[model samples]
Target chain A: MSPVNLSNNKIKLSEVDQSMKWAGLLFIISATLWLLAGTALGMISSYKMHNSNFLANLEWLTFGRIRSAHLNAVIYGWCNNAIFAVGLWIMARLARTKVRHLGLLIIAGIFWNIAVTIGIIGILTGHMTSVEWLEIPTYITPLLAISYCLIGVWGIIVFRDRQSEHIYISQWYILGALFWFPWIYSVAQIMILFEPARGTVQSLTNWWFAHNFLGLWLTPMGLAAAYYFIPKVIGRPIHSYYLSFLGFWTLALFYSWAGVHHLIGGPVPAWAVSLGITASVMMVIPVLVAAINHHMTVLGHFREVIESPTLRFVVFGALSYTLVSFIGSTMSLRSVNEISHFTHLTVGHAHHGVYAFFTMIMFGSIYFILPRLIHREWPSKILITCHFWFAALGITIMIVALHVGGWLQGLAMNNPELLFIDVMKGTIPWLKARTVSGFFLAIAHIAFAINVFWIVLSVKNKPAVIGTKALFTSPHAK
Target chain B: MDWYYYILTGFVLAGLIFISAVYAFHWALKNGQLKDLEKGASSIFDDDEPLGEQTDYSLSKSNYNLHTTTANESSKFIQ
Candidate 1:
């Protein structure tokens, strides 16, 4: 704790920051490019829902192919790569080690992007698997799998080389996520795709895999980022370590079991559905534990959280995590599931988790991380404000329209007197509203991309100005 | 046949996860990892120096036992 030691530690972390510069920049830039691409594809798919003939002529632009393309591009391209950038940086930073395998990571990152490119192309070419989340063709999955392992190895190495004896809670979540993903992914791929599990088992494996992908992989990484940034930015410890322990273990226990709820009312055994419903509802424990822990830590710091872009986005994400999780738990109940199961309600719920909860947190973490890695202030607070409002407002509208429309659609479908076409017709206006929200999200992402490029590409290293009104305080200042 | 196996697999996976959680919780408790509540939470901010002088005041009062080993300070000195 001597000043001399502190100085040395600063120098060491500064080196680690410099070491991550190129790989982090590449991962982020690639992630943003894919975000732009995915948003475009999403708009096309959304528009086609209401106007099926908009691009009906082009076989490649057919709704089915384009929709699958959109998912893979966003999930693998944007989400995965962004996690690589942000998550790996976090692992390296908290591990207090320079990234050792920089060259391998870059190579792995390149191949990861290439593999996803081939996967998207495969989907467009009518080779997509009919499975919901695993729609990417079989040939490209191994490449994606292998490259993910390669990138994941660096995190493991950083943990191995960590100088600190007491591992932070974020590392536990990150490490668990790093290891859990490939295990689940490989099992899902082998059982469902390669061996082709018989009948409803395929459905079981599909939902199990898809839901776990969100629960274990994306959720842990998002929570880890939140755990790190909320405490760091607010300059306070978490509310309680006991709650964190309970939260982590309970989440690990409950989330994996909750996946089977997705198969409710299907041919699956009633007992299995019951188990899933129980697990889903039980998820409230961990979700609230985490929510309370985060909110308590930010207690009396509301003004600070609101002022800091990073805390604002992170707190919003944490709030959405709480909201979406509760909604998810409720929707798993047989009564609620019956009505919301086959409608756009599930779609809204999905975005509420992935985009609102996970992606927004990543965006916030990037705002904190990029400035530190590049050692510069944000070029424009106005742009940051625009991005946040646009994204926030856009997603809110989309979810609301989809939820209301979906509920109505579900009701109409259940009634014997309502024609099928009538139910379909009732959803058009909502779908159009969703498309408009997509434009807002598109504008938000564009602003975000521009701001990131300006920060990364700018040559001037002007000292950052810090104030209560600043978009972000200089990383050096803290 | 597939349904039975699928059900069995789900049970096995859940059982394994349950056991793992219990084991992890036990280890955390045994190792005293769950104690020093404030220090554990602030450990992530170790790489950075203290936020400022005002932070040092609050941190000192908050982290009673390991007042000198604040994560921001300990993080710098651990190496």
Candidate 2:
């Protein structure tokens, strides 16, 4: 047993839980700031895609720059870091310990924030490699990679001291993601930035990085959250531990090879694309198993909690994870790829993963964690419900519109008689719907930012009179 | 533009619906096997208490296993 550090807990705001608390709050800040920045960039890019005159004055607000910012802020700033905060908490609690180098981890948070600041700035300043996700240029990659390492090392430190000898399903995923990220990021950076492979192969490397960016960086983290929360919510051990192993093995085996499907019928080798399609198709098994396991476990007693804002968003997100993966596999088929690959369908697919799948889970985990961190519950159930609806409806409308628009464009482009403008004419209505949907989503995000800020501020002042709840029955009211 | 296209689209949509339905059925089964819940619910009344002390599954609030048997499994009634 490790020596008791009783002195650590007696300080002003508990150094023990500080590892979890500050890190989580930083994530809330990081995610919100990035979200605001990302949405601003997204709207910019969206506007530029159609109305190219929208931001012609500012070089930093150019389409290429805005696109990169949108991706980086949302991916790195919002989702991954937020998961890191929650993942650490879940890891610590399961380990029957807190982060050992708590102070260092907090310092690493400072480092991470600094790295993201510089990376985003670098992108805006025209310092991008333009390699899709690895867009922060050579100078920023090392900083981002180093920051991730610092965070990763602390995760390993937490995992080393576990009360439960058997690693939980969530732990397996967190550990995998922790280790997998460095290897993927370092290799992608080295191959794309330093070496600069030419032409078709460079495209290959780009696709490789893009695919693995989601698979290695995100899929593991999101699944880990789902694994922890789904079981935790229902208060049951996951339906079958064996199925968890099956899901993990298949995902690791197939998903890494599955990224090249994005380059189907392109300059990449036919063999590579075929393998990608095969791997993607095989992805169905793992995705289905995971979705079934998560859904089934939360079947009965928690039907009520599903209506509860937290579970509602999380489960919807979980369902989206399954849907997106399935959609991804099917789209990888050559027949489907012909129409969907370069269309708005692709945009829809991407959002299915990022916004629907990851964001929803993040929302659920935030709801689960806030009370624990601040010792106060959310002020109003109505606001939370409205937040869920706005996001849910907005995303639903946007995805549907994109898919329909993409299909129409694909059909028109394939036809011999139709001009490209005809396709544009058809897509105009869907894009209009998307802008409206974006407004709804943005409002929801702002509402979330306010709610979280309110909860944090209320901790020192008058705590909100949170309604009676089963799990969040906190006695240590602030 | 041909009969095959019609067949293909019909088959694809049907397959998708089937897949969705199967997915739902799996969810329902996992949540609670309806027959099992019905059986468990009914068993509460059909059987009287055993000749020993009563068992309270919820006794240990924190450590309680919700999946462990609460119903009188030996008889068709609830005790």
On TM-score, the candidate that comes out on top is 1
RMSD (Å) of each candidate, 1 decimal: 5.6, 11.9
What does candidate 1's lDDT look like per residue over A1-478, in tens digits?
Answer: 3222233333355567778998898899899999999999999999999999898999999999999999889999999998999889888887776568789999999999999999999999999999989999999899999999999987899888876546678887898888778878877887788877787877887898899999999999999998888877766566776687778878888888789999989999999889999999999999999899888877777655656788878998999999999999999999988999899999999999999999999998888777667766677677888998999999999989999999998888889998999899989999999999999999999999998998888767443343421223432222
Clashing pairs in 2: A299-B31, B43-B77, B43-B78, B44-B78, B44-B79, B45-B78, B46-B77, B46-B78, B47-B77
Model 2 docking category: incorrect
Q: Which CAPRI level is candidate 1?
A: incorrect
Residues A54-109, candidate 2, lDDT per residue (tens digit)?
87899998888988988888887887678777787767755545457767777877
Q: How much DockQ does model 2 earn?
A: 0.02
Give the DockQ of candidate 1.
Answer: 0.16
DockQ of all candidate complexes: 0.16, 0.02
Q: Which tens-of-lDDT digit does each residue in B1-79 have in candidate 1? A: 4766655555576566567767867877898877765555555543243421111111111221212223453343232
For candidate 1, give the lDDT of residue A148: 97
* Full-model lDDT, candidate 2: 0.69
Q: Which runs in model 2 stand beyond 4 Å of their true positions?
A: A1-19, A460-478, B1-79
